[model samples]
Target: MVTLTPLEAELLAVAGSVPDPELPVLTLQELGVLRAVHVRDTDSVEVELTPTYTGCPAVEAMSTDIERALRDHGVREVTVRTVLIPAWSTDDISAEGRRKLREFGIAPPRAQRTAGPVGITLGPTRTAGQDPEPVRCPNCGSADTELLSRFSSTACKALRRCLDCREPFDHFKEL
Candidate 1:
């Protein structure tokens, strides 16, 4: 981990503030994809961005947004690099991001244990009788939710319908 200069930190915040192209409600910072920002020299900077997953279609849009944001902040040259060495997980989502997801009619992913491989298979329900039994419905706070589809509006999410409220919502999958 390298120590960032004050300007670099400020620029990072600016770049991170850009909203996700797919999930507009959450910023890249909250999504934990905006990995780092480095100042190469005065008016020139490089940003490290990690995608939510490999081959993510939104990576280009995210990079473009970050570039525009940095340029708007008076950066003469901005380079956004995609890094995937340390793969992103649902655990990367911040608490604030989870809250925002829930508030936005989506169920946030349950915290994943780091010790073992996560095996969530789709059956009648999305969760395969995992420790976290019910995925829960974001609309009515019901634990009797059933999986509607393995893929939701986005590949990162699963579709579920609440038995209690009969409301369908997306659940950010634990990856």
Candidate 2:
């Protein structure tokens, strides 16, 4: 297993604490975008990050924020690298992140379901036993909600309306 030096650990802490520009309430680590931080040498540090989407506009801002955070923490040299292999997924988001998202008036992504290729079917092909799940309202804790739009304030989220509260909220879409 890889071990971190004291400086590396501290650097990681600072880098992880940097918040995402779009979702100010969530840190990069909470969003699972901050992948790894390593102390390259006595004075340089390297950080690995993954974007939520391929053309996400926040990636550059996140990288700048991470570098600034590390430098502020006394790391003279910092490098932020974006890795796309093993692409990021909603599953990468931590439990704490989900909780925070719920508390912040946003519904987290639904649990993942495995399925084969999706396309136009000739007729209703029924799987042995599977049912559609409802999206819950973040504000009222009600499962009665309807999708307003596939896209929300951000590309990663969808606009939804709570039938009970009549409040529009964002739902973090599942990949």
Best candidate according to lDDT: 1
lDDT string for model 1 (42-155, tens) is 889999999887868999999999999999999999999999867788898999999999999999998877734678554455343443556878898878778877787888
Model 2 Cα lDDT, one tens digit per residue, 1-175: 4687777677778898988899888888889887778887887988999999998999999999998888888889999999986788887888989999999999998667653322322532221122265677889987777777778898899898887888999999887
Backbone clash count, each prediction separately: 0, 0
| lDDT, candidate 1, at 143 | 85
Residue pairs with colliding backbones in model 2 are none
Q: What is the lDDT of candidate 2?
A: 0.82
Q: Which stretches of candidate 1 lie over 4 Å from their true place?
A: 115-117, 121-133
Model 1 clashing residue pairs (backbone): none
